[model samples]
Target chain A: MVKGLLDWIDERFKIRDLWNDFADRPIPGGSSWFYVLGASLIFIFSLQMVTGILLAMYYAPTPDHAYASVKFIEEVAPFGSFVRGLHHWGASFMMVLVGLHMVRVFVFGAYKKPREIIWVLGVGLIAIVGGFAFTGYLLPWDQKAYWATVVGTNVAGTVPVVGGVLLRIVRGGTELGAFSLSRFFAIHTYILPWSLALLAGLHVFLLERAGAGGIWNAADRVPYKAEPLFPNQLFKDTVFIGMVFIALASMAVLFPAPLEPQADPTDSTYNPRPEWYFYFVFQMLKIFEGKLELLGTVILPNLGVAALLLIPFIDRSPERDPAKRKLMMAAGALFVATVIGLTIAGARAPIVNAPAVTSPSVLAGRAIYARNGCSACHGIFGKGGKIGPELTHVAARRPDAAWHLKHFRNPQAIVPGSIMPKLDLSDRELQELTDYMLSLK
Target chain B: MSDQDVSRRNFMIRTIIGIGAFIGAAISVPLAGFGILPVLRKKEPDWTDAGTAGDLMTDEPQERRFFQTVKNGWQEERVERTVWLVKKADGGITAFSPNCPHLGCGYRWFSQERQFKCPCHASLFAIDGKVISGPAPRALDTLSAKIESGKVLVKFEIFQVGTTKKAAA
Candidate 1:
């Protein structure tokens, strides 16, 4: 009966031809694991769309109920946690697969003359995927989401003349509130998803038109034999997708996505940190301070992205072999290393959470210390730099308050060879800092 | 084809485009308005009764939970909300928002510590809602409160967090 229905539909729509065109296409250089990244990305993207829709059924985008709605989806709805987990992990997987796919394309020089447009489309799709990560982040209305988005929108506010306008547009208002949450929801669920789908469809259509670039190392070789995509590329793609599914499922079952406390814009001690994927840029911002912040925040990042997008045009040479493309290969390697290095640095960066203390004076003193950049040179609780002696045990060594006060006033006078500069501060600040240092014991 | 026939065809095409554009505008204008108008309109303040002013103690903060009908978009529903009511030594009542000024984490009044401490960030506030210590950019947010017929009516408002100036959110 099902076969008869399919036949009946095929008679009107020519469904068999469509299946033949999709499944039995000739693939030059045949299938390899290197080619599976794109397939895996598409699979995960579809999974995300499905799971995302399910979660959206219960998610209220307003500030008043966003947190409650997410909680309902996670705890009350049947298989809600599972759906959320798949969606969560699916995002990360998409990011990873996109990166791998880009690398594969770059290594193979797949973005040659005929495929330049395809590469540009891929770059655009990457931006959309990033948009998904950013805007989707704020939907939960949790502390991490709120603060990270605050920092994210603030970064947009650093653009020279149009910065304020861009900030307002991105945030939907001056402050991150009901409108901001709703706007992010609209962008994440509606705008980005649809844009990605459209661009991704064009990208695949163009890829099919250009055909596979085939064996990077063997691009110069003559008359390449073609094999049918059915049971070959499809089989490999299925196996890899299955493996990814298992891995994502295991991760979901073992370590489900965490829900932090609901967003509180008033929590001053909470430091806004972006996701792991954004760690490289986050750490780069720390390196570029004050006057040079725009270099890290906008100029350099945009330049890098521009260069990535224009790779096919920039490297017009037709060479596809890695050995022949020495400059490009070296640059790619350096970029990867830098990203890994910065990510590690960001991971190890000191968490600036305020210590739990009841004393008002001590709290005041700690704030003063933080404001003065004492952490730059002096180590505290084994964190921070080691240029100066560790401040953790300073009170135990120097029990005199007057001595500490004198040291703050004139470091050189208190310790003749002391390299610590005498910080220009008022008497009240010195006293409070002294009291705080003593309380550290 | 005759000139008369061409003119007739042109009229048909133009009319088709005109009607198509009219239909497009008809659907899109309302859709855009539906999506954006609510976000732009100023939200009206709603006051909810907390409790009797006579039941509060001096120098102590009490948690008050009340259900207020919140009309968000098309949905009108009663949602549970909270406010910390502190009876001052001067026989006056001050209502404080539960959110910490640091990053918006809910804070609890610690009687033992004699301060309101946020669990997420440890921002401390004195009984008077002054910033005692930690990373709070400003003091605790105070809601507008008044006594009417021995009952306390509080108008809860969210302020922009992590800022020195208190701007309505």
Candidate 2:
């Protein structure tokens, strides 16, 4: 019965012939376990798609419900944690596998000749995968996601003339809020996925057309033998995929993804850091400041990508051996080293200090300050106006709390020609303001 | 092959299939149930104590801010909520939800104007929670309030904004 049904379908679809052709395809010389990275990445991506769909079944994209829905998936839904964990870890694995695959192709000189377009497609796939990660990172609507996105979008806002427009487009507005969350959710779940699927299809087709680049070692040339990609290569691919599945499963069970506290835009104490993969770029922002910021954030990164895309055009050599390609090898090594160094530096950077405590008197004083528009001239913790000295460490400089009380009542009494207005405050208001100022230290 | 050997092989196959089906069902049933359970769960109404009744002045509206623990799905968070408390002439208390009837922005009591004003869109409401002027579609939402042992407690509920009728959200 099954044979008859398959025969009926095969007449139109050529299913059996296609399977036979795929199974019998010839793998060129030097195909080994090293070639499994690409296949493994495809498997992981399939897993991510499955698990991501399952998650979207219950996820709510609104600002009020996004965090709550994720919490439901984590703590309430059965096996929800497992599914979410797989998707989360699968993303990281996909990134690592893509990197490893790119490295393998570069070292083997696969990007040299006929496979240049495939290499370009591979780069596009990497970017789409990265876009996947970035968009998905904000869907949880937690503090880490919120602040990281705020910083990430702000990085795009530094792109010279088009910066502001790009920022608005990426965020859907000037600030990160409901619109931002919804936009990210839509991109993560819809737009990027479809684009990635299409590009991935083209990428695989191009790769199949060019065939595997094969191992490039000089010593293994004589003994190298071409083999059919059936039981031999297929067996190895299955083993690698199985091992990866086990590792992913173990990771899903062991270290589930953490859902942090809900996002609070008013709370400035939270320190935002990007995911580990983005640490290098985040670190670059620190090294390059002011007008030179564009060099690190935009120009350099674009130059690197452009160079990579134009590799085949620049290096027209027929040489496939890494030993002969001394310059390319050295350049690749330097780039890798720089990225690792920057990532390490970013990871080790000091955290911002927490905001001061909000005692009753301090709260009252803060209210009084807001009411009197004191922040109009004096800056607090690097925010507000900069016409006057920063009041972040003001109490430390002038420890005598009574002086601030007098200054608020009459500014010229403390400093002649202070150009500051005198305030009318009750004794309790004066004391509360003094408490708030003293606490700033 | 002998008949007994064939029977034993068939028995083994049957056992394996049974176990596989059981395991599959075991994982899937609960997953489907949990996934749909949140949609079916009803939101339980809760009242939180605002403050002592003595703190409110007669015929005067005072803004009281307090942290209320709100539960949605599996997340429970303490969010600060503000309400306008008014002590009526009959010694009764009426609590108004702070969210404006215009666009849900928090409205504040303007002592000089003696009216509630939304800073976002300039919506104005009378001290008695009536719409006075501006873009407000209706009066301020009045929350369910009760006093026990001289303590004021209010049942806080969010209402749909930009509408003349008060509808719970």
Candidate 3:
């Protein structure tokens, strides 16, 4: 049996040669913390696949009882919570690492010239990974994913020209409905993986062919010796991996992800935000709202990336020494400054969920909630079961009664395509519900 | 001019044109590949079992997680997956992903609304993943699911998440 298995394996993948090639090569820059982010992404992806598979074993993708099933994964499946934890934290880390890798390449001018194709591939990878984060974000079907998807897609549809068509394709129809999950899941697990793997293989292949190139090496003229990728760099790689794992594990342990309320489509105050890496971009777009949505979201960033991609071709100073690359240094500094500014803007954006915490008007809100039979589809103050996002945080999150009133009266008016129906309410009823809702918090 | 001078000039021109064509072809392949990959990988609409029909209960969603070991390309190993077996109030059955369509957030069926709503943004859908309201782009995706032996199974392909089928804009 052992001999037969060995023969079968050899006849099939013939992976020995691939492994040998990897073993033989010495990577540019050998083993360094800087080089670890890309590899960490691969590690996280693998970890995500495994954990996702495990979670899926017990997960139900149906909007009905979706959260209940996830709760089962947390409570029943063997190491199910742990597995979900791994997948969750791993995803967050991958986004961070991917972002860092981009910045590293930018600063090092690794995308310059002969490596332009790689840079293009890198950009494509980043976008795909963001999609990965987005799709994966909804896998839990909790409050955050539900509200975020709605807000996120609304923003997506604002894109010009083919935006509507693109929106339809993504939702698998007109709204974020059934086909959307199917489409995203298929994309996430099937399409995205294959694309990423192909890109990853190609990226590494080119890396091997061209080696790592940058201004640091130009002064050396002579290609310096690098440690064999096997033991030397591998050990360092292992150390970095260990550090990442510990950090991720700590996060997973300290705060297992919180499941927000079941989605209700009717509720306003769906304050959503992207993962941290996206926070800066999200923040940039927020600032651009009502002013330069197009330039901020589409044109400006694309131009920045374009410049980054063209760095290798431009600034072709004959010198390779880092000390001599003053213009290149200045350009890098400018880009970093820009990104930092956007991130700061994002971090400081008006807190959409703060004011509600200060006010309490549960009596008025509860009256309306009861009158509307919101309890039928939603659980409130831990009274109802899983049907929609618990309104426990509604007041805490959306404090302004007037804003909430405007949002509640006809959410679709304020938020186009909102699932919430416009409630026919007198000003008194609105204020009463708002007060009651506020009191619950 | 001598033969050497003429030959050298022709050689350089040809080399440049050859390089340009190669670059153009290289770019085109990836662009075309991106467009065609979806069509190429679409699954044939065929019946695949999700699990033992007996395991599914009536009027409530039963979470079924299943796995299979198959050989595809170079890898062969057991892969796990999940789906919900929703027995409708009228005893009808459907299997769907908990993932909501509104921005890919997971959604739960609200027995109260007799609809599905996203907890993240309040997007509502009917029992079957239809967009009942709130920022949803489409309805729930239905899996080609059924029951076979006393076992749960899915037409499983362990694909990488976070790639493919991009959102608009």
Candidate 4:
């Protein structure tokens, strides 16, 4: 039945010839496992496409419904959490694969001579992937997503000349609102995907025309023995894809994607951190602080990308072996090392102006406040159960520290019908807790 | 390659195939559930107040248009719905769904013929909602309706088309 059906369709479409042209290829060197990275990336991209479409069915691109819709998908829809989990983990996987693929190509000297166009297309693909990550991050419209976009757009605003216009264009207004969510949704779902697809198609077409880079050390003069890519390379590719699938699926099942609290534009104390892949750049901003911030925010990153795109032409040596290209190889390794080191540092970096720097009394008061469960009703720094009035600006309401101390001692005496219980705390503890309360504002 | 090397490669391929199948199961199970579970789940009937019961008290079927707040996905949309209400000889109100049973076309109440005529498929339903003289497989579907405080309320629903049974679509 399948053969007859294939014959019927193949007669009209000539799918056999197309399949042969695509699959029947020869590798200059017998297929190696290193060639599997690109295939794994393509597979992950396909997975992302499917999961993204599924998510879009449930997602609403507006300020009012975006967070609630995501919540509904996660908590109500069947298999919604798992599908979202796959997409989230799949994004991280794609980033890692893209990096690995680029590194593999660079180390193999595959971007030299006839394959320069492929490298250029590869660079464009990388930028599109980065665009995907940035836009996809904000679709949840949560605290982390919103703040990260604010920081991201602000970073763009640091660019000279057209920074203001660029920021306004990106945000769709002076502040992130309905337009920002809708714009991000459109870009993430429509614009970036189409661009990536077009670029990737051209990249693969160029790759096929140029063929696999093969063994770099294979003497150009000699005719090296070649093996067909069918069972040899394809087997390796399938195995690698399968392995990646297992790891991604495991991660998705174990730790599904998280949805933080809804975005609160009024909260200034909330520290926003970019996704892990962006840690290097985030750390760089910290390194080049204050007046020199423009260097890290704009110049260095652009320069790095320009350098990468120009590498093949800049290093004009015909030698493909790493041993022969010592200086270039060293520079590449150093760059990779620096990025890794900075990422590690960023992960461990302490929060600026954290409560640790506060006076001893304030620190003791924070501990006392926690012990007394004061946060149950009164919220500070945007963290609390919030059953009562928020205490984020409590100091502004009651400037006198003595009033707080008195309120702690006797609730009904200070304010009639006050629901606050009289805490049996020591005088020192009361003083400390009051100090912590005053420090909030 | 040596015989041992071939065997090792085969074993590796088998292991990879096992993992591939595991991954397939993981994805397909969730995907199947995601697609099917929502469809299988029953939707609660949402009743909307169409108009005043006294206004619709007549022998002829009255077409009442009302806005219904419907929760579709995460959005709450106000959709315009129409229902044909008929005041019987006993004075009890019967609300008929506006669509033809054959293919879900909007049917009109023709007072001259005293029947609901569908323009799309030419299906005709009598004032009593029975198939008068057309290709309609069953009678016109009735909406769950009640009169409360001089207001006519209707619980709107869509039924499966081209079917003998009045199953909810």
Q: Which TM-score values does chain B get in all models?
A: 0.78, 0.74, 0.59, 0.91
Reproduced native contacts, each prediction:
0.00, 0.26, 0.00, 0.52
Per-model TM-score on C-alpha atoms:
0.61, 0.65, 0.56, 0.78
Q: Sort all candidates by lDDT, best to worst.
A: 4, 2, 1, 3
Specify the highest-lDDT model's number. Answer: 4
For model 4, chain A alone compared with the true chain A gives a TM-score of 0.79
lDDT of 4 by residue, A1-441 (tens): 999999999999998897777666777766899899998888899889888998887889999999999998888889988889999988889888998898888888899999998998898899999999999999999999999999888787767788777888998876899999999999999999999889998998888888877878655635676655665677788888988988888888899898999999866457788888888888998898555879999989999999999998888777888888889889999988998899999888886664522678887887887887888887664356657677765776787999999999998899989888998999998988888878765
Candidate No. with top TM-score = 4
Which pairs of residues have clashing backbones in candidate 4? Answer: A365-A432
Q: List per-prediction Cα lDDT, in the order shown.
A: 0.81, 0.82, 0.65, 0.85
| Cα lDDT tens digits for candidate 1, A1-441 | 999998999999997897788766777676677888988888788778867876776679999989987876666555566667877878888888898899889988889889999999999999999999999888899999999898788788778889778888999987899899989999998999999999999999998877777676543446665555655676567667767877886676677777889999767567678888888888998898556979989998898889889999999888888889999999988877898899999988988665433357677888899998998998764445879987865776787999999999999998999999897988988888888888654
Pairs of colliding residues, candidate 2: none
Q: Per-residue CA lDDT of candidate 3, range A25-81, in tens?
A: 765544455676777777677767656665655566667656777776665444445
Candidate 4 structure quality by residue, lDDT tens digits, B129-148:
99977889999999999888
DockQ for all models: 0.01, 0.12, 0.01, 0.34
**Quality of candidate 3's docking, in CAPRI categories?**
incorrect
Question: How high is the lDDT of residue A286 in model 3?
Answer: 67
**A-chain TM-score of every model:** 0.81, 0.82, 0.73, 0.79
DockQ, candidate no. 2: 0.12
